[model samples]
Target: GAGVSQSPSNKVTEKGKDVELRCDPISGHTALYWYRQSLGQGLEFLIYFQGNSAPDKSGLPSDRFSAERTGGSVSTLTIQRTQQEDSAVYLCASSLGVRNSPLHFGNGTRLTVT
Candidate 1:
């Protein structure tokens, strides 16, 4: 895909279950990011991967949320022990990892926890 791609556009999971959301950035993009958007809210930054350096996970809401970028391309966000409060749209974005580079975004995966 030319733009960032996210899988399982919609997910329904039970409370206490685990969920893994995937993101594939454009080929050669050095920066990938994960964000979450709750209903009627703005995007919340989650994690960031820039090249071989350690990822910035400062934005993660809790210990249950984690993410990784392998080979500087594909990334995944895992939420353990899903809760109703975790329901949101997980958005993935990518850029050149340079200053002022525009990020390309995916439609996002809408997760619902029951």
Candidate 2:
């Protein structure tokens, strides 16, 4: 894809279900980031990956949220034991991993927990 791509544009799951969202970064990009936006709210950083360095997972709300990047290309975020509060649009972005690199974002996956 020419830009960051995310799968399953929308998802609906029951409370306590697990959900997995996938992202494919633009070719050759080394920085990937995950963010969540609640309805009419600002984006909240969830995680970040840059090259092979350790991912910055400090923004994850709890152990139930996890993410991994493979081969520095594709990434997946898994939400375990989903709650209603977890419902939000999950966005993925990629950049060149350089200072002041602009981020290209995916359309995001909207997850709704009932």
Candidate 3:
């Protein structure tokens, strides 16, 4: 794909259920990031990976939230024990290996835990 792709464009799960969102970055891109955007809020960075390694995973809200990038291009974000508050758009971004690049985003997976 020319752009990033994410699965389950919208999800509705019961409260306390777990959810997993996936992201496929542009081919050959070595950097990936996951973020969450609550309604009416800005994007909050969650985790980031460079190459096949993650040097930063500090932004995960809690142990319940985790992510991993495989082969440096695909990523998955798992939310355990989901809550209504966790109902937000989970976004994935990828960029060239540089600090000064614009992040290209997948149309995020909107998780709605009711």
Top-lDDT candidate index: 2
Per-prediction backbone clash count: 0, 0, 0
Q: Look at candidate 1 and tell me the lDDT of residue 35.
A: 90
Instruction: Order candidates by lDDT, high to low.
Output: 2, 1, 3
Compute each candidate's TM-score over C-alphas.
Answer: 0.97, 0.97, 0.93
Which residue pairs collide, candidate 1? none
lDDT of 1: 0.94
lDDT tens digits, residue span 1-114, model 2: 598999999999999999999999999999999999998889999999999999999999999999999998999999999999999999999999999999999999999999
Ranking by TM-score: 2, 1, 3
Q: Write model 1 residue lDDT over 11-104, tens digit each, in one string.
A: 9999999999999998989999999999888999999999999999999999999998877789989999999999999999999999999999
**Residue-level lDDT tens digits of model 3 in 1-114:** 599899989999999998889999988777888989997889999998898554598898899998877666678899999988898999998888677888899999989999
Q: Give the range where candidate 3 is weakest over 10 consecutive residues by summed lDDT.
A: 46-55
Candidate 2 all-Cα RMSD: 0.8
Candidate achieving higher lDDT, 1 or 2: 2
Q: Please report, in order, the local distance difference test score of every candidate based on alpha carbons.
A: 0.94, 0.97, 0.88
For model 2 the TM-score comes to 0.97
